[model samples]
Target chain A: MVVNSSAELTDDEVDRIFRALADATRRDIVRRTLAGEASVSELAGAYSMSFAAVQKHVAVLEGAGLVTKRPRGRERVVRGNPDAIRRAQRLLDAYEQIWVARIGRLDALLDDTPPQQ
Target chain B: MVVNSSAELTDDEVDRIFRALADATRRDIVRRTLAGEASVSELAGAYSMSFAAVQKHVAVLEGAGLVTKRPRGRERVVRGNPDAIRRAQRLLDAYEQIWVARIGRLDALLDDTPPQQ
Candidate 1:
C-alpha cells in the first residue's frame, strides 16, 4: 500500500508546519493538547493572550495538520496529531542522514575504498 | 558534566530554529550545504534572488544554529550542522512520546491495569 506518511510531506506543507510551530504559545498549546485533548476556551484560559489570538494560533496549527479540531458541544476540542510531529521529525532525520552519507563517502575516499570513476 | 544538548533548548531557541526553517529557500540552502559546504556567493549564484537576499537567509539559519559560517579567504563557507537538525527532531520526538504515553495510559485504564490511587 502507498502509505501517506509525514515522510512524504510536500515543501509547502513543511513550510506551514514549521511556521506554525515558531511561536512559544503555539508549541505549549500543542504539548498540552497532545497530553490531553482540550477545548479552545480551555487553551485560551491558560494564556494571557486574547481568545481570538489563541483561536488564530489554533487555526494556523489546524491548517498545518499539526492538530485536529472536532465539535464538542459549542466548543471545538483540539487534539495534537502525532503523525504531523513525526512528519517534521522525519524531514530533519533525512537531512541528518544526508550529512552522514556525505561524511561516509569522504571517509571511504581517504581509506581503502576506491573512488567512483 | 554540563552538556548543552538540543534536548535542553529553551523556548526562544526553539522559536528561532523553527522560524529559520519555515522558508523553502532556507530549507534548500540547508539541504545543499548539508550535502557539501558552499560559500554565500556560490549559494547566491544558484538562486535567482539577490546576493543580499541569500545572505539574509544564511544569517537567519546561522542565528538559529542550523548552519555555521566561517571565514575562508575572501569568501565565507556555510555548512549545515547536523546537531541543530537533531535538536529540532528531538523536540518533535518528545511531542510524539507525550501523545504515545497519553494513549498508553488510556489503554491501560481500559485493560486490567489499576488506576492510580
Candidate 2:
C-alpha cells in the first residue's frame, strides 16, 4: 500500500497549522528561524517578550509542525520547516485553482449567451 | 500620489483574512463558492448546517473580502473575489520568500566556513 505523507494531514492538523499562522508574532518567528537556526535563548533575546513567552510561541509552532527542534550540545536549536510551509501554500493554490476554474466557466457562459436580450 | 491598493492591507485586515480562513467549514465554503458563484440558500442546502449558519460563514468571508455579494433582482449573488485571494496568496508568497532567502544565506555561510579544523 502507498503511504500517506504529511500532505494528507487531517482536518485537525490543518486547523492547527492555520491557527498557528494566524498570529503575527508566530509568523515572524517562522520567518526568523527559516533564515537561520537559533537557540531558544537567542530567540528570546531578539524579541521583547520574556524567555518563557517566546518558548510558548515556539511550542505552538512546533505543535503545528511549522518548526522543529534539535539538540545542539546543551541548547536546542529551532529551525523552520519549509515542507510544512509549502504544504500550506499548496492548499492556498488549490483554493485559487477553484476560483480560476469558476471564472473560466463564467467566461464560457457569457460567450455562449447572445449579446442582446 | 498613486493610491494604495488592497495589497497594502492593514494588520487588522491581515488578521481578519487569516482568521476567516482558519475554520475548515469556512474554508470549504470558500472552495465551493470559488468553484462557482453560490447563493446563500444554495450553500445552506449543500451543508448540514442551518441557513443562518451558512449565512454567517458567508458574512465572515465577505467581511474578509474573500467573497462579495452582488444584488441580482431580489436575490443577492455571492461570488469569490479573485483579487482578494491573490492578495492573500501574495502574503504567503512573501513568507515563503523569507524562508528561501534564509536558506540561501545559510548556504553562503556554510560555503565560507572552513570544512575542517
Candidate 3:
C-alpha cells in the first residue's frame, strides 16, 4: 500500500512542525506528554514559566498538530500526537537519505575508476 | 562501540536545528546542498528572494550547523552536513520512541486486565 505518512507533509506543515519544536520548553512538553497525558495546569507546574506562557506553548504545539487537547471534566488534557512526531522524523529522514545516497554514488564512482596516482 | 550519534544533541542544538529547519527556503537549500554543493548565488537564483535574503538564510543554516560553507576560489560552496541532519533525526526519534513505548505499555495493560462488563 502507498502509505501516506509524515513523509508526505507539505512545506507549510514542515514549517509548523519544526517551528513548534524550535523551543526547548515545547519539546520537553512533547516528551512529557508522549509518556502520558497531562493537564495544562499540571504541565505549567513543572516549568518555571508562568501558566499563561505554558498555555501559549501548548497552543503552538497544538497549532503544529504536535499535540491535542481534550476536555476532561474541569481540565483540558494535553497528549502528544505520535503521528506528528513521526511526520517530522520522516522529513529529517529524507534529508539524511539524500545525503546517504549521494555518498553511495560517490563511493561507487571511486570504486569504478582506477587510482589517480 | 558506544556510538554517540545525533542522540547526543543538547537542548540548544535541538532548538537551533529545528529552528533552522522551520523555513521552507532553508530546507530547500539543505536539500540542494545535500545532493551536491552549490554556491549561494546558485541557490539565490532559484528563489525570488534577494541575494542578501538568501545569504541570511544560509547564515542561519550555517549557525545551526545544518550547512557549511567553504571557499572554493572566489565563491563559497555551501554543502549540507549529513551528521547534523542525523542529529536532528535522532532527537525526533527519541520523541517517537517515547510515544511508542507508551503505546506498548498501554497495550500490555489492556492485555493484562480482564474485559469490563
Candidate 4:
C-alpha cells in the first residue's frame, strides 16, 4: 500500500526529505509541528539555537515538502505535511518489499522443496 | 508494529541512517543489494562513477548499518540489512502515529457532535 502511493515523489524530493530529516533539530521541529502547528519564533524559543538557524531548518523542511508554511498575522505557521511523510514511508516500503521477496527466495532455497501439508 | 521495533535504534543511529539514504545513488545501491548480494566490483560496473566512488557510497551505507560487506575469496560482497531498514521504518512510523493522532483530534473538533447511529 505504501509503495503504491510512492510514485508522486521524485528522487530529488526523496533526497530532500531524507536529508532534512537527518538532523536532530529538524526532526524535533517536525515532531513539534506535526503534533501542532507552530511559528518559527515558537520553534526557536524551544531550542538553544538562534532564530535564524531555526528558520533555516524550517526552510529545509519546507523545501522537502515535509512541512508547509502559511501566513498567519504576519507570522508563518509551520505544519508537518502528512502526505510528504507518507511518500517517504512508501519509498522505504518499496525497499522493504525487495528484502521481503529476497528473504522469501532464501526460505525457498533452504526448504529444498515445498513442505508436505 | 514498526514503532515497537524502533526502540532498538538511538537518535544518532536514526540520523546516520537517513543521512546515508539521502543520496540517490546510495539508495539505488540499497535496492540492488536488497534484491541480491553483489561484489563491490560488480556494483561499480553498474554505475557511471568510478569504483572508488561506488565504494564510498557503500561505506556510507555500511556506516549507517544499512548494508553489510563480507569477504568472498577475492572481493567483498555487499548485502542490504533488513534490520536497519526496519529501524528507519520504525522512526517514520513514530512520526506517522503523531500525525494520525493529530488528524483524529482535528476530526473530533470538526464534528458538531457524535453522529447518531
Q: Per-residue alpha-carbon lDDT of model 4 for B1-117, expressed as tens digits?
A: 123343566678788899999999999999999999999999999999999999999999998989999999999999998888878888898898999999899988879676679
TM-score-sorted candidate list, best first: 1, 3, 4, 2
Model 3: residues with Cα > 4 Å off, grouped in runs: A1-7, A111-117, B1-7, B111-117
TM-score of every candidate relative to the true structure: 0.91, 0.83, 0.89, 0.87
lDDT score for residue B50 of model 3: 100
For candidate 1, what is the DockQ? 0.84
TM-score of 1: 0.91
RMSD values for the candidates in order, in angstroms, are 4.2, 3.9, 4.0, 4.9
- Native contact recovery (fnat) for each candidate is 0.93, 0.66, 0.99, 0.89
Q: Give the lowest summed-lDDT range of ten residues in model 2 chain B.
A: B1-10
Candidate 2 error regions (>4 Å) = A1-6, A110-117, B1-6, B110-117
Which candidate number has the best lDDT?
1
Those runs of model 1 whose alpha carbons end farther than 4 Å from true positions after fitting are A1-7, A113-117, B1-3, B113-117
What's the lDDT for all of these models?
A: 0.90, 0.81, 0.89, 0.89
For candidate 2, lDDT tens digit of each residue in B58-116?
89888888888888887778887767767777887887898888778889989999979
